[model samples]
Structures are given as C-alpha cells and as structure tokens.
Target: MSGIVTELWPYIVLILVGYLPNEVWRMLGVAVSHGVDENSELLIWVRAVATAVLAGVVAQLVVDAPGALALVPLSVRLAALAIGFLTFLVIKRSVFAGVMGGQAAMLIGGYLSGVSLMVP
Candidate 1:
C-alpha cells in the first residue's frame, strides 16, 4: 500500500546511504588497484581506512544490535567477538568461519545466560 511504502522509504534510503560510501570506495579501489603498486601510499591509506571502518562497523553491531545485543550481556558479546577472532586465526582468515563462529557463540551464550528469547 502507499502508506506502507511511505513508512518504508526512510529505511530504504538509510540502507542505500549506509551502503554507498563503502561501495564507492570498493569500486574506486578496484579501479586503482590494477595500476597502483601494493606499497603505494594511496593503497596503504585506503587499506587502513577500510580496516578501521570494518572494525567500527563490527563493534557497532556487537554493541548495539537492537534486539539481539539487548538480550545478551556484555560479557557474552565480548566472548562472541573473541570466538570470532580466534576462528579467524585458526581458519587462516576464513571469513565464513569467523562469521558463523561469532553468530554461534552469541546464540549459545545468550541461551546459557538466560537472556535470550523464549520461543516454542
């Protein structure tokens, strides 16, 4: 319905707004990386900024995920982060392992802490 779409428009805009900066950087990086040396200052700065942004995003997700983090204690969140880090190390930076391990840790830790949702 028109009313529903009006309500959702802000959320759609927010998603595109959040995504645009990262996607732009990615496209620019890809375009430049072909000709740029790996040790170049521009590449180094881009890598550093990208790393910082990724870390900030992950931290925000862990600390402020609306429904999920609110249902878990800080310790559980920290433990999940640690598990994700360890999984990354053990798997030689396998992104899938790190993500799945972190999610699994959060789910298990939340249930163990009796702070999770009670669903049938």
Candidate 2:
C-alpha cells in the first residue's frame, strides 16, 4: 500500500494542485447558478464568454498545435472541425456525436498521413 502511494505521489499531487483548484471554481459556479434562469442575460453572457474562450483555444490548437497534433495537417484539422460541427448540428446538438465524429476524422487523417498509433 505504501509502495503504491509512493509511486503514485506525483499523480496525487497533480490532482490536488491542478484539478482541485479549477474544480473548486466550477463547483462554486454551479452552486451559485442554482435556481438562476438558464436563458437569462447573465447566463447568456457567461455562455458567450465560455464560447469565445473555447474558440480562441481551438483556433490556437489548429494554427500552432504542439507535439503530436502538429503532425496532422492544418487542412485536415480544419476539415475535422468542420465535420464535427456539422455532425453536432445534424445530431441535434449532441456533443458526444460531434466529438466522436471529429476523432474519427482525425484518426483517418493520421492514418492517411502515416502517423502511427500505439495499441496496448
């Protein structure tokens, strides 16, 4: 037991230091948002801010992707994003379908580009 904890100490620290800090604000937001009107102006503003941030991050990843993601072509990345968004709209705003569609497109691109995937 102690040996396992010792080996996993870094992971435990990361959860406490990284995840916990961000999760606390999310939890607080949920708590505060309770009973608030979902379609209200405040919520709309929040959604807009979140969407803008997400778009910025996505744009950055597509334009200047780091590490393995950089291997995939920009055109392929853009295509995958488009396919995913189309799938989301077609599927009645199903986020799962959108993500799966995007991932499938990305994997297909990776295969076509000769990038290797490891299977355990």
Candidate 3:
C-alpha cells in the first residue's frame, strides 16, 4: 500500500500542475467576460495576437521540423500552407478543413518529391 501510494503521488502532482494554471485562468476569464462586449477593442486585439502567435508557431513547424518532417522541402510546406489558407478562406475559416487540406497537400507533395528523387 505504501509503495503504491508513493508511486501514484508523482502522477497526482503532475496532473495538478498541468491543469491548475489553465483552469484558474479559464474560470477567471469566464467570470470577467460576463459583461464584456464580443466586439470590444481589447478582445479584438487579443484575438489578433493569438492568431498571429498561432501562425508563427505553424510557420516555425513548417520551416524547421526535425526527423521525418525535415525531409519535405520548404517549398512544399509553404505551398501546402498557402493551399490550406485558401481552403480555410473558401470554407468560411473552418480549421478542420484547412488542416486536412494542408495535410493532403503535404502528403501528395512529399510522395511526388520522393518519387522524383528516386528516379534521378
């Protein structure tokens, strides 16, 4: 019993540490957003910043992926991103559609490039 409890302690601590900060902020946001306008300037700015950060992260991944992803050419990744973005716009900004389109593009591009390399 003692050994089991000790072994479980670390997992419990990890769960708490992983969830507490985000949960606290989310609860606070819910409380504070009660009277906030959906179109408020501050909210709009926050949304824009969040979107920019997400874009930067995606760009970083596409540009600097390691291991298997690194094998794909940068041009292919950029082209995939462009296709994804256009698909997103065409589909009224659906993230799922955008991601699927990008993934499909990457797969097709990677296959074609790999074939070309093998032929030469």
Candidate 4:
C-alpha cells in the first residue's frame, strides 16, 4: 500500500546509501584492472583497505545482525573467528581448514543456543 511504501522509503534510501559507495569501488576495480600490476602500491593499499572494511562489517554482523549470525551470542561468534584465524596460522594459511573450522564452530554454537535453524 502507499502508506507502507511511504514508511519504508527512508530505510530503502539508507540501504542504497551504503550500497552505492561499495559499487563505485567495484566498478572502478573492474575498470582499472586491465592496466594495473598485481604488485603496485595502489593495489596494495586498495587490498588492505578492502580487507579492513570487510573485517569490520563481518564483526558488526556477528555482534548485532540477525538471520545467519543471530543464532549465537557475540562471544561465541568472536571465538569462532579467533579459532578460524588460529587454524589458518597453524596450517600455513590453508583456506579450507580455516573455513571449515569457523563454520563448524558457528554451526555447533548455533545448535547449542536452542535456535531452530531448520525453519529458515
């Protein structure tokens, strides 16, 4: 209804505000990739900033967001991340080990939290 649309329009706009800036970088990366070298200083800075931003977003989601991350407490989520990092460190940065460890922790913690994950 028009009333519902009116109420939600501001939130929709706010979502796009966060979305557009990331898209700009995505488009720029695609546009610039052909001419750039893998070892360029600019590329290194971009990679670092991208990693930091992604980590920050993931931390925020683990701490407060619902859906996938809402099944467990913040402490459990942080523990999972720490475990994943340690697994990566110990295994010489093996991606599969790191991913599986984190996912196992999240799934086990989520199960222990009494959340009905089957519903979603």
Candidate 5:
C-alpha cells in the first residue's frame, strides 16, 4: 500500500543505499577469507591496519568531536571512554554493555556539566 511504502521509505532507502553496499563487501570478504590462514602475516597486517584506523577514529572523536558531542567536556568524554572500556571488561567483554555504559556515562556527565541540549 502507498501508506506502508511511504512510512517505510527511509528504511528502504537505508537498506538500499547503506546496508546493501556494505553487506556485499562483508559477504565478499567472508567468501574470500574461507581458505585464508588466520595466522598469516598478511592477515596480521590487515588486522593491525584495521585496529589503527579504529583507534584513530576514536581518538579524533574524543579530541575534536563534532556537533553536540563537542559540547561535552574533554574530561567527561575521556572518563566515559574509560568507563566504557572497564564495563566491557567487567561484563566479560560484551561490546553491547560497553557501548551502553559509554552512552550512559556521556549522558550523565553532560547533564552534570550543565550542557543544555538546546544551546541557543
């Protein structure tokens, strides 16, 4: 129905424009990695590069956040990051818990810092 299509348009667009493109590459990677040795030097290098990229992104977000995230004090962000990592470890390495903990910490810290969501 037109109503259903209209309501779901954004989700449909997201699947087509965002999810599918990335998923294809993920599937291709899985297919190609089937016979690859996990301990191979090439894989190790790839892992290291991936880790470095992720670390750089995290560092950038903390050091120079964009939009509303920038309103958060650097100390609060740093504390949130640490709390998130500790939550991850304390929760037996559950990434979901870590993310939630980080998000919660950020919200609490931001509130405590008197950051109004609507900054005139």
Candidate 6:
C-alpha cells in the first residue's frame, strides 16, 4: 500500500494542481454572477470570445493535426465540418447531432477515399 501510494503521489499532485484553479474560478463566477444579467454586454462579449476561442481550437486541430490525425487530408476535414454545420443548422443546432454527423462524415469520407483511420 505504501509503495502504491508513493507511485501515485505525483499523479495526485498533478490532479490537484490542474483542478484547483478551475474550481476556484468556477466558484468565483458563481459567487459574482448572482445579479448579472444574461443579456448584459459584458456577458455577451465574454460568450462571443469563448465561442471564438473554441472555434479557433477546432480550426487548429483540423489544419495542423499530429500523429494519426495527420493522415486525414484537409479537404476531408473541411467537408466534414461543412456537412456537420449544415446538419446542425438544419436540426435546430443540436450539438450532439452536429458532432455525430461530422464524425460520420469523416468516417465515410475516409472509407470512400481508401484512407485508413488507424495508425499503422
């Protein structure tokens, strides 16, 4: 038991270090947002920035993927994203449906293109 605990100590510390800051900010947000309006300009700006950041991350992933993802071409990713976005818009912006549709499109496109999704 002592040896096992020693081996896991680094991971435990890492988890705590990673989790504490997010937890602190979450609690702070809850504390300070009690009387804030959802439609406030500040909130709206924050939402927009957050969305932009998420989109940027996705774009980065699509454009410069590493390892197995690098094998998939750029055209296929863009096509998948387009189909997924259209599906999302058509289905009233259901995120689950959008993600699933995108994944399905990628898989089908990969298959038809004779590209293996698995790392060799």
Best by lDDT: 5
lDDT of 5 by residue, 32-64 (tens): 899889889989998999999999999998989
Ranked candidates, highest TM-score first: 6, 5, 3, 1, 4, 2
Between candidates 3 and 4, which one is better according to TM-score?
Answer: 3
What Cα-based lDDT does every candidate model obtain? 0.86, 0.91, 0.87, 0.83, 0.94, 0.87
Winner by TM-score: 6
lDDT tens digits, residue span 1-110, model 3: 99998999988887799778668988998898898899899899879998999989988998998677888898998999999988888998999999999889988998
Q: Candidate 6 on 8-113: residue-level lDDT in tens?
A: 9999887799878678989998998899999899899888998999999999988887776676788988899999998899888999989989989999987787
Instruction: Give per-residue CA lDDT, model 1, range 33-71, as digits (tens).
Output: 788887889878889998999999988977787775687
For 4-115, candidate 4 gives per-residue lDDT tens digits of 9999999888778977877898898689898889899999998999999999998887778778567577877888888888888898899899988888887787778775
Error of 4 at 29 (Å): 4.5
TM-scores of all models?
0.61, 0.60, 0.62, 0.61, 0.65, 0.67
In model 6, the clashing pairs are none
- Evaluation by TM-score, superior candidate among 1 and 3: 3
lDDT of 2: 0.91
Q: In model 4, what lDDT does residue 118 have?
A: 77
RMSD to the native, candidate 6?
3.3
Alpha-carbon deviation at 113 in model 3, angstroms: 4.2
Clashing pairs in 1: none
What lDDT score is found at residue 67 in candidate 4?
80
Model 3 regions lying over 4 Å from their true place: 66-68, 88-97, 113-120
The deviation in Å at residue 90 for candidate 2 is: 1.1
TM-score of 2: 0.60
Better of 5 and 6 by lDDT: 5
